[model samples]
Target: MFGFILRRLLSGVVLLFVISTLAYMLLYVGGGNIARRILGQQATAETVAQKTTELGLDRPLLVQYIDWLSHAVTGDFGTSWFTGEMVSSGITSRLGVTLSIVIGATVITAIVAVIIGVWAAVRGGWVDKVVQGVSILGFAIPGFLIALGLVTLFALNLKWFKPTGYVPLTESATGWLATVTLPIIALAIGGIAGVAQQVRGSVVDALQRDYVRTLRSRGLSFNRVVFKHVLRNAGGPALAVLAVQFVGLLGGAVIVERIFAIPGLGQVAVTATSQGDIPMVMGLVVAIAAMVVIINLLIDLLQGWLNPKVRLA
Candidate 1:
């Protein structure tokens, strides 16, 4: 298990390196007149040149990347080109807001999906139909629309949650929950739809297997047979789906955060990209890539634990 975990971590690190390098190259090579944009249209040519040289944009792309990477490894992402804020500090301040929504959505997706999926697979009548219908609706509706609807119905009409603004958990736990609840729900709906379907299918397949019959013949109770044996076999695919959903939730949080007026990495990402703030953008790229790599590693570890065959593979 230790070896397996080490191997996964090594691969994750490699993936992070590759992603960060690609993002750096793409941003530097394709992003046009970053200095001019930062300096404004009225700036003189000599001024732009001075700004460019000051930013080390005049250096070779490879050299620039190496310099950035060297600083990045030491947790020194440098100051933003546009705002002059420390990239690390800026991102760190907003990271928690985005993570709260995404992680909360993921947890809700896993638990609710499992329950609904298992119920649909076991009952197999109106309950199954209703689950299927809801899954289809979930797939059809975009997350942003869900966010809008939730804001309107719950925040505006019912006065359940605040329409916009975030409260830090450190400030007040209940206030934070109230603020984030709608955004989390909006992000989680689609994830639940996708993962629930996967769970339902896997559970159904497990129920039809010969092992299920064997367990039944051995006089195991229905609940024990399903929960202990069937779910164990079916859990792998559901977990895989849930991991994918978690990544999607990260992307979805960008839009949801905007709608909810939450101060998060999403706002910074949009502003940085638009302004061609390479240092800030690169910081975000590295941070998001590292997160994805870590999430994938965790999923791989869970998969290996659930199915020893996965470790062999």
Candidate 2:
């Protein structure tokens, strides 16, 4: 297990390096004349040339990449071209908001998916069909549409939650919940669909195994057999699927954040992209990729713990 974890961590490091390198190249190499964008269209060529030199655009690409990587490793992502603010500070301030939404949605998705999936699997017939149908709808619908529908109902009509705004968790739990509820729901709906389907399918497959029948023959109650034997055996695959969905939710947060006007990493990323803020955009991309890698590693470890066969593999 230790070796497995170490290997996964090393792989994650390699993946981050590759992703950061590609992101850096796309911004610096492909972006062309960033100093012009930063200095505005009115700025003279002499001023632009000076700014380019100051920002080290004249340096060799290899040297620039190494410099950027070294500074990024130290959490010094440099200044935003447009705002002149440090990229690290911009990202750090918004990271909490995105994390809260993603984590809250994930927790909700896990509980709801497991219950609905397991119940549908046990009952089968119409229940199973309904769950599958919901899963298809989740895959088909866009998250922003769901956000708009939710806001129209919960915010516009009912006035229960705010339509758009963000409140820090440090301020008030109630206020935070009120602010984030719609965004969480928007994010969770599709995830619940995807995860519940995986769970349902896994549980259904687990139920048909000879061991399940053997447990029933030994006079174990149906619920006990299903929960203890079936779920434990089936849960490994569902956990893997859930982890994938969680990573996807981080990316999806971008659209949801924009729709709801929430100031988060997603919002920051979009703004940075529009303004050609390479440092800020690279910071956001690397942060999201690192998060995805960490979550996937944890998932693999959990799966191995649950299934010894996985550990051996």
Candidate 3:
């Protein structure tokens, strides 16, 4: 198990390195007149040139990347080009807000998806049809639309949650939950739709397997046969699907965060990309890529634990 985890971590590091390198190269090459944009149109050509040199934009791209990577490995991502805020500090301040929403949504998606999926698979009648219909609708509706609908119903009409703004968990737990609940729901609907279908399919397949029949024939209770044996075999695929949904939730949080006015990496990412703030943009890219790598590694470990055959693979 230790060796399996070590291999997964090493692979994750490689993936992170590749993703960061590609993002850096693309941003550096495509970012046009970053200094001029920062300095404004009124700045003279000579002034812009001086600003560019000061930022080491005059350096070779390879040298610039090496410099950034050297400092990045030490947790020094440099200051934002426009705001002059430390990239690490800025990200640290906002990371929690985004993570809270995405993580909450993922947990809800997994639990609800499993219950609905298992129920549908076991019942196999109107219950299955309803689950399928809801999953389809969930896929058809956009996450932003869901956010708007949730905001209108819960925040505007019902007054259950605030329409916009965030409250830190450290400040008030109830306030924080109120602020994030709608966004989490909006993000989760789509994920639940997708994962529930996967779970339903996997569970149905497990039910049809010869092992399930054998277990029933051995006089095992129905609940025990289904929960202990069937779910164990079916879970591997559903977990894979859930891990993918978690990553999708991270991207979906961008639109949901905007709709709800929660301060998070979504805001930072949009602002930095538009302004050509390389330091901030690169910081975000690396941070998000690292998160994806870590999440994938954890999923791999979990899958290995659930099925020892995965470790061999």
Candidate 4:
């Protein structure tokens, strides 16, 4: 296990390097005449030259990339050229808001998906029919639509919860809860639908196995047999989907974050791009890409751990 974890960590570092390099290059291409724009076309030659040197836009691309990579490795994410704040600090400070929404949604997704999914699978009559219809409805409705509808129904029409905008966790816990509640519901709606569908399929297949027949023939109680013997094994496949959905949300659903106006990584990335804050945008892109690679590597490890055949092989 230690060796496996070590390998995953090493892979993560390689992925981070590749991601950062790619982001740097892409930003360079996208940021047309950046120094000129920042300093203005009407600015004096001296001003343009000085700003260019300061931004290292005058340096060779290779040299600039190396400098950026070195600073990233050293945890000195450097100052945002646009915002003039330390990149690491900027990202860190706003991370909590993202965390609250992601964590909340993940917990809800798991609880709701597993309970509803397994039930629908094991009891495949009206339970299956109802679950199918609901899950399809969930998949059909996009998150932004759901979020808007929720805001309209709950906030505007019903006046149950307030519309979106973050409230800090430290001062007003209840307010924070109210603010995130809508976004979480928005994010979770699709995930639950997908997980339930996957679980239903996986569980149905698991129940048809020869071992399940043996258990039934042996006179074990239906509940005990399904929950104890079948569900755990069936969970392996379903868990993979759940892990992915968790990562995607936790890393920040950019669209949903924007719609709800949650000040998370996604929102920052958007703002940085719109303002052409290259350093900040590159930092956020690297962070998000690294997050995805790390999560995928973890899912690989988890899959191996749970499946005995894979472990034995």
lDDT (tens digit, per residue) of candidate 3 on 1-313: 8889888888888887898899999998898888899999999999999999999999999999999999998999999999999999999999999999999999999999999999999999999999999999998899999999999999999999999999999999999999999999999999999999998999999999999889899999989998998888889999899888988998998888889999999999888988999999889988888888888888888888789999999
lDDT per residue (tens digit) for residues 142-252 in model 1:
999999999999999999889999999999999999999999999999999999999999999999999999989989998999999899889999988888888899889
**In model 2, what lDDT does residue 43 have?**
100
Worst 10 residues of 2 by lDDT: 24-33
Give candidate 3 misplaced runs (Cα > 4 Å): none
Q: Against the hidden reference, what TM-scores do the models get?
A: 0.98, 0.97, 0.98, 0.91
lDDT of 2 by residue, 79-143 (tens): 88888888889988898999999999999999999999998999999988988898899878999
Q: How far is 190's C-alpha from truth in model 4 (Å)? A: 0.8
Which portions of model 4 miss their true places by more than 4 Å? 41-46, 250-252, 310-313
Is candidate 2 or 4 superior in TM-score? 2
Off by over 4 Å in 1: none
The lDDT of model 1 is: 0.92
TM-score of model 4 vs. true structure:
0.91
Candidates ranked, most accurate by TM-score first: 3, 1, 2, 4
Better of 3 and 4 by lDDT: 3
Clashes of each: 0, 0, 0, 0
